[model samples]
Target: MSTQFGAASTTDDVLAGVDLKGRRVLVTGASAGLGVETCRALAAHGADVVGAVRNLAKGEAATAAVRAAAEASGGSFALIELDLASLASVRAATDALVASGTPFDLVIANAGVMAAPFGRTVDGFETQFGTNHLGHFVFVNRIAGLIREGGRLVNLSSAGHRFSDVDLVDPNYDTTPYDPWQAYGRSKTANVLFALEFDRRHAPRGVRATAVHPGGILETELARHLGEGEVEALVTSLDERNAAAGLPKFQLKTIPQGAATSVWAGVVASADDVGGHYCEDCHVAEVHEGESMDGVRAYALDPEKAKALWARSEELVGETF
Candidate 1:
């Protein structure tokens, strides 16, 4: 496919002339930030949207715009309860979906925690890894059958994935000291690897999967874990580094811009171009090395690493797909 969209494109921009009247999409983390915008954009294009949210009350309140857009476009929006931090909740929610037997054209794993303080999930894994990766790992695999052939899965990874690779041996930081950024990086990297492997496993059935980095967007709840001035400080630091390297200063994206890539990869782009890859700014990213904030790291897309992480994830969640 020709590249027509770029970094500044919004969800609406990507879906401008697309029609989705008979399609169904499932978006996790649909209550806030990029998730909400993704749902709204797809629904506005006439897709039936199921938003999987952790808090029903919060989701209902946050998705009012989504509902209105869907109503106006002849689409529909509904919320399903799903808490990624707990295995029990993941199982229950997925089981119900599977029982419903309704097929989905796409699934977006957009829920995740970023730079959180050290903690563990209900199932005893590190908080970030558990919620961001393992939880979706099981959730998606459980409903893999519900995804129609030729459907797709878009995992919301991050540019932060360059910070570190997954530590399969010490996933919970059992021995190594825990650092919030590193933990978040590991989880984000796992997101990419998960997509890579899932695409490989399901591509034969015409179901594709890919991961996306939504670009930095500060006006969202994702930064709540940051200290009062930490966001500002981080941005300044990044700008300084970029200036030293003769690169443009770092800039944050709007929620719509951040969500553009997700919808693009899941709906607009050719599945063959995006399958088993990591995408950003509405395009497939190249494998880049070093400390730059632009492209996916090789380690994140290593097929061997993806396979290992998939196996380890199954072990951790006590489930296989």
Candidate 2:
């Protein structure tokens, strides 16, 4: 794919001139933030979009723009109830989708919690890990067959994955102490590994999967758990770290800019270039061994680790793909 797009590219910039009239897409967390922007852009380009939300009322109220865009562009938009924090909800949603027998051109696991306080999901797993990783694991795998042969899966991972690798043995924090950021990190890393393994399993059928890190954006609902002044302090710390590494100060992206990479990988970029990889800023990220915000970590893409994670996820979810 020859292109000129980067960190600053908005969803519209990445999708300019592209028509998705016959495409069908599923975007989770569609009620707010990046998910809302992602759905709006895809619908505006003529894709039939299904926005999955934990709360239908909130989703309907939040997606007025998406619905209007779809109507104006000859595309379509609808909503589905999904709460990634609950296995029952995931099962019900996936079963209903599979029963509909409608195939999707792409499935973007764009819903997730970030740096949330310590808590357990409905199934008693750590909040971030359960909602961000395990929920998508079962949700996607169960509906894997509904993805057309050439379809793709885009898991929304994060640069925060560098905080720590998944602790499979202590995933629930039973034996290990709970730290919100570390838990979030584990879940984010699981997101990347899940995409990697899913790609390995499905690529032979022409279905591909990739993970993307939407650059930091402060205005999203994702920061709701942070206390007053925490965002400012976090930004200061990040900038100091970047400056010490001789890099420019960290800059938060707009929602459109933040969601750009998802559409780029899901629609614009070639499968061969992004399949089984971690992407950021509309391109495949390099594997960086150290702590930095610019690239993916080696451990996050380890094939063996990905496989291991897949197995453990199956065990925890009590479901096999």
Candidate 3:
């Protein structure tokens, strides 16, 4: 089956005729933007979704919005607390979920911050690296048992991964000059590596994993770190380039469009048998070549790097699985 749904496909469109009854989906960063849309679409398709957000008030509002949308469309959703910057928070949330005795059929590592000013997480690692990569690392490991066999993990990465791979020697920025965008790139690269390694290690346990570049949805929380002018300039530059290539306008994806690849990865049977691939525009993206900003690079998908990253992550977060 072709996974190449275009920018025009809505969440409902990708999910049509796909039944998710009795399935449970856990989505982080569910307060607004694509996360809310992802949760809404999953609920609409008969999956019970848990929206995980850091702020309770915002999460409640987000949940209400999804509930309202679901009521009109016939679906269901709930909300929970999860702060990716703090290992304690990740642990507490997973503990609560375990206490509730629910096994997740899909776990979407969807919450992340981008290009924030140099800072450290509560765990003392660089904030972006800590939250974006390590947080999901520990979270998934903590709840590995609760994932149903044949379950899937969807890591929300970005094309910015083309900017740089992990600085293996100084992942925390302790030994290098900190560049915010580079740090963000490392974190995103980490996301891809995480999926690659997770699939290698856990696929045998019946847990499959994939990472996705959710197609440049501009309004997601990650954009908060960019100035308005910077955002405009970035979009404008991409637009002109796409036009020059005779491609469609480089439009910022709508929430549903942005989320299609991830939602598809979670439920697609074709994906069931294929793990460790990077996806974009709802398809397995082609590997790119020198001096271009697209597709998964070799090092980012390297099993050795993935394995090393997993080991470093265990040391960084002090968690073993």
Candidate 4:
């Protein structure tokens, strides 16, 4: 039970000495960045990994390293087509997964879009909400039955959740002004809430869920929408927010370091202890009040709000799971 890892931990550090010969894992957005690193680490430890990506052509090239790593550990890796921006793609991907009859030991909702200019997904919901929250909501439910009893669901959230709680009543910004950061925050909050409700409902079945705020942000694909000046402004904003939260000075993390918390939540943490918790820096993060960064907010972890959001999501997606 000792916390053997920290912000400096890597995926290999968390998985060291742990055997995953027969384990199955699925990582969303595995075409590049943290997703690629996560799969490479898992596959190197003998876990069969499926990397879900939006572009199969690009994904195949991206996952080549993972496949090579699997060879050394007697594991395997493959890419599956998945576009979170499109519900049809989600369903199609889920159908393929179910038909394959693979009992996944862990599913990491790792793909996300951040702070993009105002837009809607193909499904007509706000781009962030639709792609980051609702897309995973439907995809996970469709594959829920395939997860083994002792499996885990690792939902990748962000420190940005502190920016705003989800405006459930008008999540799509129907009447409100569209602020990109606020929308991203709302989506990240939904990620946390989803993990909360998911753990509440399924923990008894021995499948636990966790939401992770991977520390140390850097320029990643998630920043695709930011222009040159905007990126610099974001860095300054993050530092100011951390100071306001009474946290230490901020330092951007390399991809491997940033991916550590999610990897820990997915494979290293004990299911019974970590389910439904918001994690960062390889441990449970504190809930900070009146802060726009650094830790989880109370609203994101509220059970009642989680349930309400779950229901709203079901309605938005027009299906009951």
CA lDDT, every model vs. true structure:
0.95, 0.96, 0.85, 0.89
lDDT of 2 by residue, 169-202 (tens): 9899988988999999999999999999999999
Prediction 3 TM-score vs. true: 0.94
Clashes of 1: 0
Give the per-residue lDDT of model 4 (tens digit) for 181-218.
99999999999999999999888899999999876466
Off by over 4 Å in 3: 69-75, 239-249, 272-274
Q: How does each model score on TM-score? A: 0.99, 0.99, 0.94, 0.97
RMSD of each: 0.7, 0.7, 2.0, 1.3
Of candidate 1, the 10-residue stretch with the lowest lDDT total is: 287-296
lDDT of 2 at 151: 96
For candidate 3, give the lDDT of residue 79. Answer: 88
lDDT at residue 216 of model 1 (Cα atoms): 93
lDDT of 3 by residue, 93-150 (tens): 9898888888999999999998899999998999999999999999888887888998
lDDT of 3: 0.85
Model 3 alpha-carbon miss at residue 211, Å: 0.0
